[model samples]
Target: MDGFDAHQRQMETLCGRLELIADLLPDQADPTLCKFTSDGIVKTLSDAQAFEEKELFPALQALSLLETDMKEIFAQLREEHYEDLCFAEEVRDNLRAIIEGHPSQSANATGYMLRGFFEKLRRHMAYERYLVSALRTKKAPGTPDAS
Candidate 1:
């Protein structure tokens, strides 16, 4: 499968595990589990963002016809990437706290954090996928005319 599909699959799996962890936190389940799961989420997402910015963004920018729209979208995406990295780090720290026996938030609060992170992350991935699809169907400027 393509890189996007593979990244998405990994994300989905990690999210599912996080959802389960969120369901039983601060009072139930093994706290160490959160540490493991959060680490994977952080690493995988960080890698995905790095890959997209380094490789995908440059390629998309080369499509002159889409440059203006892509500039806006790419800017927004970079902002989101910053926000997401901060959020992921927070989640990892919180999970690490749980593992270290120094939990700060209640079960509900931790659960909310996990849900918020995953849901927002899913939305981010969806937007990227849409852009990739657009590349396939839309013609690029400065290229030989198809018609």
Candidate 2:
């Protein structure tokens, strides 16, 4: 109903979609399925990064500059974002390698790596939700808020 609520919902949906794709990845054994899932994951990661850059990062920046606790929280979030960047990069590289006909071991390793990345990413999303909830509670009512 409110801006914070909307943002929370959006974040939840985004994370859910990512989880769905991650879950689907293991079910795929054929190389084509692997490629499809890899591409899908890369796309999802790109969308997530764009959302963070355009929306989350700016909001966190404003909050950090204005509130001490928010600044700490933002620092943590920024760290998580950096981790996400690494995971996304690894996923992209692995996917590219697979596309390039890299060895089967590389594909297997990438699959394992992706599983770990997704798990970490899911935890990071949960942490972000907690941070967002805290900020939302602190924000003044009737103030315009970004989605």
Candidate 3:
């Protein structure tokens, strides 16, 4: 599959997992669930970041497939990636605290953080899908595929 399609699948999986984690946050009774979700988030974010930086961004740049305005969009997406990384790290820290017998936030606070992160992730994915559709619509000047 294309990079966009693969990324979309990965994102779909991540979002589904995140949704489950969000649902579990209210009870805060399962340390195993917290650990599993935290680990998944860390791994998924790392893989997604690497794929975007090493594969997707380079290909887009090499082909000049995106319009000039897309540069701003790319920048914003990169920023969002950074933000997601930070959020993931925070989640990891919370999990660590729970594991280490340290004081942690209330269940409500944890739930709030998770819900906000999930919402942001959904929004980010939607924007990326829009960008992919836009790129698919654009063709180089004078090309046979140009409309």
Candidate 4:
């Protein structure tokens, strides 16, 4: 497949993983189930980061100087990536507390915080998908819309 097609597939896969985490968020808030859910989220984020750093980031860098629109899209995506990192850090902190056998109240509080983070992350993924779609369309100039 072409570069755009490959990128689109990668984005879709990443979004699918994010959706799984989003779906598990409520269950994860149970404190008892938090460890499994947190593990899943950490895995998902790590996979996403690997894909972005290895594939997407390089593509964005190469394309950025070729088009103003592409550069702006890349910038927005990079900013969103930073936000994702913050979310991941929060997740790590919550998981660390849970692993340390924090008080029940603390576990519940962390679960609630994790739920909020999941919601924000879900929205961020949707926005990133939209931006990626737009960038793909713009990058292809008259190519038939495949997204």
Scored by lDDT, the top model is: 1
How does residue 15 of candidate 3 score in lDDT? 69
Candidate ranking under TM-score, highest first, comes to: 1, 3, 2, 4
The prediction achieving the highest TM-score against the true structure is: 1
C-alpha positional error of residue 122 in candidate 1 after TM-score superposition, expressed in Å: 0.5
Give the least accurate 10-residue stretch of model 1, judged by summed lDDT.
Answer: 138-147
Clashes counted in candidate 3 amount to 0
Task: Give the Cα RMSD of candidate 1.
Answer: 4.2
> Model 1: what TM-score?
0.82
* Per-residue accuracy of model 1 over 1-147 as CA lDDT, tens digit each: 136667777888878877888888657847667767866768988888887898667666776436367788789889999999899888888888888888778878888999999889888888777766665556476533222
Candidate 3: residue 21 lDDT (0-100): 63
Q: Which candidate model has the greater TM-score, 3 or 4?
A: 3
The models' CA-based lDDT, in order, is: 0.77, 0.58, 0.68, 0.55
Taking every candidate in turn, the Cα RMSD to the unseen true structure, in Å, is 4.2, 4.7, 4.2, 5.8
lDDT of 2 by residue, 1-147 (tens): 134445445545544544554455434445554456556654565566566656665665555534466556656766777777677667656655655667345444655676677677767667666656655665545534543
Tens digit of per-residue lDDT, candidate 3, span 72-146? 766877898898999988977876676565638876786677778878887877876665555557544543221
TM-score of every candidate: 0.82, 0.59, 0.74, 0.53
RMSD of 2: 4.7
* Model 3 misplaced stretches (Cα beyond 4 Å): 58-68, 99-103, 139-147
In model 1, what lDDT does residue 125 have?
81
